[model samples]
Target: MVHEKSCLIDVPTAEHPRPAAAATLLELMHAQGEVERLSEREQLLSSLLISVNAVLWAIDWETRRVLYVSPAYERVFGRSASLLLADYREWRNSIHPEDLDYAERSLARVLEQGTVEDREYRIITADGQIRWLSDKCYINQQVEPGKPVIVVGIAEDITEKKQLELELHRLATTDVLTQTSNRRHFFECANQAFDTACAQGAPLAFLLLDIDDFKEVNDSYGHLEGDQVLRRIAESGRGILRRGDLFGRIGGEEFAVVLPGCVPEMALLVAERLGKEIQNLSFNYEGQAFGVTISQGLANLTEQDTTLDNLFARADTAMYEAKRLGKNRVLAG
Candidate 1:
């Protein structure tokens, strides 16, 4: 049989690419013994590779033809070795439509620089949902005049990792009970509103509301029902507000409403409507119907109310007035 001259194997009585060694049987016996351990090492390496969970693949450097695929491909790509033999386009096509452009750009950079590339992309699985994959790729060209420098890539599903990251981000940005903006996110939204107000020379007002008898509810009905009331109030407040307005739970049962590009008159009107909505809401507590209400204070970020603290103080005073004058009415200051 005619073998490629560059074949990586030794032979007898032929032009073997492995260093040509001709000696007596006793001398060759020592050489044969030396290679015995190498066979065991090769088996160990092959066993380790086949058992790995990461999907391993090799593609031709020039034509991008599929050269080798590991058994793990069945778990990730759900395709047989035979299907990916001809070209890499099949795998490329399997990539999520939204991620194709980014994958192409990453691939182009890898080819131009011959540098190792690590990337992630989503792929539609046999199931309908998108599954994310993270990959590490490197060029392997150890042998000279090798059949186009083969690209070796390893991929593993990272969908869980992505989900964890998204959930972490949401936890940071969202209020746990109310699902509205938390204190940290409240500041972020207010900063944007401040920018808008400054750019347009329009007024920005903040309405801070606190449940007058909130602690009583918690002490009487337990924290679980109190939490339910908070969530219901937040949902009802959202219904009354516009899309651009920002509402956040800043403290235990204290919430802040940020209105950008709004005057005193407009803000008072909005606050009054929201106050009644909260009062009318019949907060449910463990299959039991109950009546609950809140007192709110309004403060404008005018020249007089300089800092957030100063503005909040005014709103706090106004809110106490709301409680003093009879709890359910809006105290627009």
Candidate 2:
């Protein structure tokens, strides 16, 4: 395509009016060549921009109108650029309700501070899928004084990245053998529960339990059977516990349960019920039948309990007491 500036290239007025006119013809030819080269480069740049896997957009600061958007909008968000350009409010509406305020605040910050680093937010796509996007935006205010202050933004889909991150976190926080919360995550959850219980003045119960003869089972059968026993125990406990209760494996064959809104008596009842369920589970390894039992210690939240460690220690002591009294029994501290 020829530009208006390209059409103004001076050519020879006469066949050979003078040497100056001949020189002007040469200059026109050179200018025409340069314009063609520039046009080719522009086409290449446009192609690259459209083929990219990111959303490239420019918005008019004054009108908040979408000045330009790349074709990738359809590929990424399942929406047409025309729809966005027709009404910039569509862009705002596309943001997830939980993240709309954050997105707006980020834009406001860019407008106020004149620069912004990359920020991440979620969006509800046209196809009804949640997508994570990382937006890198900057303001361009160096244009003509009367012209609009433009904000140029590039947003890329990061949903896969976010999912992978969550998977890794789950792996880190969960027990590999029992599929329960690991020690560190258990403590993290317990700390939160403790703080909430203290703030709300609500009752909380802690149960520390140990599998009876776990080492003997591992020694008689292979570690594989031992793992199966642990998994079974965890499954049984989860089935017996409430939705809000927290159960985790704190050590080898040692597990803890946090029962929110539970008093000492209720906690003891839960422990007894869990022990009964475990006692009924029959373990068979190559036709050798056996059963597993758990000894539990229960403790309730008290005003003197300053930290989770204190509560956990009392429960642990009670658990040892149950073990000392006999196997497969519950004790209260």
Candidate 3:
């Protein structure tokens, strides 16, 4: 019998390998190593993106499509990332109505400026909470010659910082004791009102009020009772003044009011009402009841008054005159 010739060749071993076969095996090994390294790097990058607090996002400028958004997007925006990716208007709808125009214009400027760093605005979240964001965006510089423009941005939640700033401003501008405008802030606002009234050719009146025998009250009733009196007087003044009027505790026992567009008669009427309100407030200390009164001096804006200081000076003089004449009365300077 004739035997058929065997077609199978012997497998090459490492000790006795062909050159081409050896090269192929080495290439396969190298490719496998490269793929493993690449996968590890991808995992590390994903971990970093997931761990960050700020939202990282990308968008296709030409299509107005959201390309990618990191995990933090859902946490900060209180909205679904899937929805944002599905429709670009999801982002637009989240912007505060008052800041929509500004947000759009600032984002558009990034096309010409290459980067926008100082973009800050407010957004309404899905839960109807208003949050502030400091969103910075830049154009990708590695695009091909002809390709859709990609915009990348990082948005950081700055709501806490903004709230802190507002609180600090309130502390700086408001009196801690009486909850009215402090001395410095009162003058600042009064000066602005004075200039506005001058520009509009409107009548403005400044009224300075002093609590009568305030020192004696503090001595007789203790400092706590004196503080209560001050607060009650401030509340009464606030109740009597109009919306546009500026009231502030300018001194220990002195409060000032700047009435915009008020004639002399209207200012006098407001002062009288405030005085009566103060007089009606009864205080009790150690089972003893006592009441307080205020002396007020009113001054009207004149052509000779160049600044608020001039108006304030005349009112101050009149207030002292009221004190000298009798307490619990109003006098026009």
Best by TM-score: 3
Tens-digit per-residue lDDT, 17-51, candidate 3: 76887789989999999999999999999999989
lDDT of 1: 0.81
Clashing pairs in 2: none
Clash totals, every prediction: 0, 0, 0
- Pick by lDDT: 1 or 2, better one: 2
Q: In model 1, how large is the Cα lDDT of residue 185? A: 93
Regions more than 4 Å wrong, model 1: 1-46, 60-65, 79-89, 96-100, 116-118, 141-150, 163-174, 179-181, 188-207, 219-222, 237-247, 257-277, 284-288, 295-333
Q: Best candidate per lDDT, number?
A: 3
Error of 3 at 35 (Å): 3.5
lDDT of 3 at 111: 89
Q: Which residue segments of model 3 deviate by more than 4 Å?
A: 1-32, 142-147, 242-244, 263-265
Per-residue lDDT of model 1, residues 1-333, tens digit only: 886666454454455443334456557898788788888898888898778888898888678789888877767777655777865777887789999998778866666666555788898765556888888787766535745677888888888999999899999999989999999899887877876776667798889888878888888888998888899889988998889899999999899998887788999999888878877878666686776888889988776544566666788899889999988767766
TM-score of each model, paired residue for residue: 0.61, 0.79, 0.83
> What is the C-alpha local distance difference test score of each model?
0.81, 0.91, 0.94
- Give the Cα error of residue 135 in candidate 2, in Å: 1.1
